[model samples]
Each structure stands twice: as C-alpha cells, then as structure tokens.
Target: MRAIFPIVTVVIVAIIGVIVFHLLSFPMPWMLGSLFGVLLTQLIWKIPMKWPVMMRNIGLLIVGTAIGQLFTFNILIAMKDTLLFMFMLNIVLSLFCLAMAYLLKKWARIPFATAIIASIPGGLSQLVVFAEEQKDIDVTVVTFFHVIRVLFVVGLIPIIVSLTGEVPGAPAQGSSNLLHNLSLILLGLLLLPIGKKLRLPVPHFLTPVLIGLLLSLFKVDVDPMDGHLLHIAQLCIGAYIGLLLHPKSLRLPVRVLIGGISSAILLLVLTFFIAEGMVFFFDLDFATSYLSTAPGGMDQMGLIATALQADATHVTIFQLFRMLFIYVIILPILKWKILK
Candidate 1:
C-alpha cells in the first residue's frame, strides 16, 4: 500500500505534465512535462516518490538504440575531422572549471574542494561518487548545483532551438515487422550484460548504442523505434530524474544558491562561445555545435539533439568523447592535485 500510493501519485503527475506540455505544443513534451510535473509535486507536497532503476535502464536501452540508428561511415569520418577541436575544447572547459571554482571559493565562502567538485562538468553521478571519497567536500551541494544546472540547460535550450525556426520532421514510422523488432530487442538485451562486464559507463545505454552503430555501418536494416515507444522512454527518464530532487538537499544559504546559479550561467555563456567556434571552424550547423559543446549528461543532451533534429551521430560522438576525456584524463589530474 505504501508503494502503491506514491506510484499512483507520480503517475497522475506525469499524466498531467504530458497533457499540459502537449497543449502548449512543446518539443519533447513527455520528457519536459514529466520532469516539471514531478519536480513541482515533490517540492510542493513534499511527497516521497520513487522511480525504479530497472525502468530507467529500459529507457536508456531504447534511447541508445534510437541514437545508434543515426550512425554511418560518413558520420564516423566527419567525427574524425573534429578530434583536434574536441581536445582543445576539453582544455578550455577545464580551465573554465578552475576559474569557476575560484570564484565560488572567494565569493560563496565554500571550501576549495567542494567548489572544485561542484564546478567540474562531468556526469552528476560521477561527481557525486567522487565527492563521497573526499573528506571535506559536500555531496549535497554538488548534487544541488548539478541538478539546477541540468534543469536550466534542458529547459532553456529547447526554447532557444524553437526560436531558431527549425522544426524537426515528424518521427519516423518504423517497420511493421514484429520479428525484426523482436530481434533488435533481443540484441539489445544480450548486449546489456556484456556492456556491464566490459565496465562501460551507462552500460545499458552505451552497449546497445555500440551494437546499433555497428549494425548501421554495415547497412543492417533495423527499423527505427515508433514515436510512442520513444515517448514512454522519455517519460521514464524524466520521472527518474525528477524523483532525485530532494528539496531538503538544498539546505545551503541563499548566497550559495546565487553563486551556483551565477556559475552555471557563466558556464552556459562559455559553452555558447565554444559552440560558435566549432561552427566557424568546422562549418557545422548551429544546433549540432551547441549540443556537442553543452555540458549536460550524455543521455539528456543526446535526447535534446534528437528532439531538435540535429545530427545525433555528431552530437553523440562529441558528448561521448568529452565524457571519456573527463573520466580518463581530467579526473585523475584533479584527484592528484586536489586530494594530495
């Protein structure tokens, strides 16, 4: 009974969010709607909500497969051309993180370790886990900063895209072959454990994505997912993220919130400049460049690219590259310098 009430309430909130977003004709209505709906419900009612991890993993699998359908030999070749630019951008973003940390330490009176951890543009889960190992850093503050930054970017970027007058085409109507769809599903399921064994980040999603990309390059005729299935996936992702918002986690002073917001805005501005550089140098489209440079998580940014009808292949390549670089190169340096 306890679980049932929270589940029912969350469902009701999700339904209302979907309806409202649909009425407003918003892009990626299911995702944004459910996110906002559950966030508001949790904040106002203080109700305890839970989103099953299994549901979120299923959503990741679907999204990863959909993105993989965009991959091709040509896309791979194009990504190779931008490798230098991606590496340069990583350096620039790292410097920016250090600058932001300095400002937070000076203005907000936060500890240097906490400021630096909060300022890093890595994945939220990665940052939180890293914070757990540090003695003086505040995990709640880092989480609060990341959650707010994600909300800001996700909400604002879609509106910016809409104003640019590039309406995405209708979702592809996939093949009606039940057998083919089942085969694809089976392939994704089989890859999940393999991805885990390989220790891939976000294995449920990345594993399917890697498999789908291989199939796409080989000209395999896997059908695209139906629009309804995609929406369900979005709903699961949005609800899961929404349930993570614990208002009590944000117990910092007003000045700390202000500082975090300011730092987030500064990061967005820097992202805009970097994206413009990519467009100017690489001759890429605006949406793809912006999405590639955005500091949001892999899945969230990928979804935004899909929503905006940008080159999902390019966006995915850049985002995955940056994520891997942060985890591999930048994080180790930070651990050595800051922890020692």
Candidate 2:
C-alpha cells in the first residue's frame, strides 16, 4: 500500500496538469501539462513522487499501435522514395550532433565521450544507460544535458506548429463499437512481450509499430484509437518525462547549464534550416519537415506528428532510420574511434 501511494499521488498531479492545460488552450495539453505539472512540482516542492516504468511502457504500446494503424501499401510506397533522402538526412544530423558535442566538450570541459553521447539525439533512458556503462563518462552531466534537450524540444515544437495556424488532418474513423476497440487494444498488448523478447532498442514502442505495419500491409484494418485512450497514453508519457530530471541531481556549474540550454537552442535553429531545405526538395508541408528534422526521439516526434495531423508514417520512418543509424553505425564508430 505504501508503494501504491506515490503512484496515486503522481497520477493525481498529472491529471491536475491536464486540467489546467486544457483550460489554458495549450497545444498537446495532456502531455505538456502533465510533464510540466509533475516536473515543476518536484522541482519546487521536492515531493517524494514515484512513477513506475510500467506506466511508460503501457503508454508506448498505445501510441505505437495507433501509429501502426496509419500504415498502408500506399504509405509504404510513398516512403520508398524517401529512403535515400532519409539516409542522407541521418548523415547530416549525425555530423551536426558531432559538431554540437565538440562545442559542449570545449565549453563545459567534459570528456568527449560524455559530450558525444549526451549530444546524440536518442532516447533519454537508453542514452543514460549507455552513459552509465562507460568508463570516465560523467553520467550526471550526460543526463542533465539530455534532460534539458528533450524538455526544450518537446515543449517548443508543438507550440511552434500550432502557431503556424495549420489545422490537423481529419482524424481517421474507427469502429464505433467500444468492444471491438478494446479487443484490438488487447491484441496489441499481447505483442508487448514479443517485442521485449526481440531485444531491440525501444522494443516496447517499435515492436507494436512493426507488427501493426505488417498487419496493415496485409490489409488488416486497425483504425485510429479513441481520443480518451490516446490522452491517457500521453499523460503517462508526460508524467514519466516530467519526473525524469530532479534539480537535486544536477551539481554542475552554471556554465554547464548554460551550455546545455544553448546547445539545445542551437540544434533547433540548425534543424529549422535543414527542414526548410526538405520543404523545398520534397514538397512536403513545413510541419512534417520540421518535425522530421527535430532532434528528438522517435516516440516524441511520432506523438507530435499525430497531434499536428502531419504525415506520421513519414516522420516515424525518418526518426526510426536516424535512431537505428545512431545505434548501429554511429555508436560503433564512436566506441572504436573515440571511446577506446
């Protein structure tokens, strides 16, 4: 019962955030509100709050399944043309991150390995674990850097998209039958363990997406999820991220803090320029292009795509390709050339 208390407290706080953001007409209120609510509460009050990893995994499952339903043969065919483009985009993004890492190393006087790992735009939890495993890497600094970056990217992107006055695409129709939707969600839940067993990075999220994509290719008709369920998922993820960075965990100098924030802002500026190039070359909307190029995790970008009614499949493909590139290719090179 004691363990359950903190969980309940956290949920209540997140819900309050949702309500406040909703009232304020904020973009992605359920997510941003919950994240800020929990984050600010913890920072100011230093409350003893705990959110379990299970909550985050459940959220990912819902989001992944919904995104998977967006897949179709037509979408896949459209994506085929972008394969080469995404490859080149990832290369550019990697080089840009390396440049940022170099600046961080020089400004903050940290090890190159730590700066590089922190600067790489990957999942926060995974990078934290990777940093923890390395010798002579400051996990605290890396965590601080990523925490600041993710916060800035997630907080800023939605507002920017909304400010452009672009309306979301029409939401797809789902079966009106509540039972059918529940059944479909259960089927997705069953895939969670299979995803875990695959030993892939972000298996909890990507596994459902891959399975959903396969099903969609074969003409399976999974539809968009109910808004309420999606809201809950967003709330879960937001709360998890909100609770991620405790002010107490950061003992670094003010210079490191400034450097981290400056790097995040610089990365966003660079991404905007690259996104403009994509808009010209690909003939895609600015929202889709910007979200695709933003230095954020696949899950966060996917969520933003869905919210903004952008081509989520396109964003997912680009983000996933970048993620895999970083993990499989870039990390290996860094390990051998730099970390060694």
If scored against the real structure, what TM-score would every candidate get? 0.93, 0.94
Off by over 4 Å in 1: 167-179
Per-residue CA lDDT of model 1 for 1-340, tens digit only, reads: 9977877788789879989999999877888898889988998886767777877777787778778776777778867777888898989998989988998999898888899889888787778898888888888889888887887777677776677665455555556454565476568888788888998877877787888878977788777765666788788888877877688856789878998788778888889788777778888777888888888888878877876778777888888898899889987888899865
**Model 2 agreement with the true structure over 1-340: per-residue lDDT tens digits:** 9888888988999999989999999999989999999999888885679999989888887787778777666877878888888888888878988998888888888778988998888878888898888788888888998889888888898888788776466665755455655666677678767877887668767877887778877877665677777888899989998988887766688878887888889889988888888889998887899889898889888887877788888888888888888889998898889886
lDDT of each: 0.80, 0.83
Highest-scoring model, TM-score: 2
For candidate 1, the clash count comes to: 0
C-alpha positional error of residue 280 in candidate 1 after TM-score superposition, expressed in Å: 3.3
In model 1, what is the error at residue 305, expressed in angstroms?
1.4
Window of ten residues with lowest summed lDDT in model 1 = 165-174
Clashes of 2: 0
| Deviation (Å) of 46 in candidate 2 | 2.2
RMSD of 2: 1.7
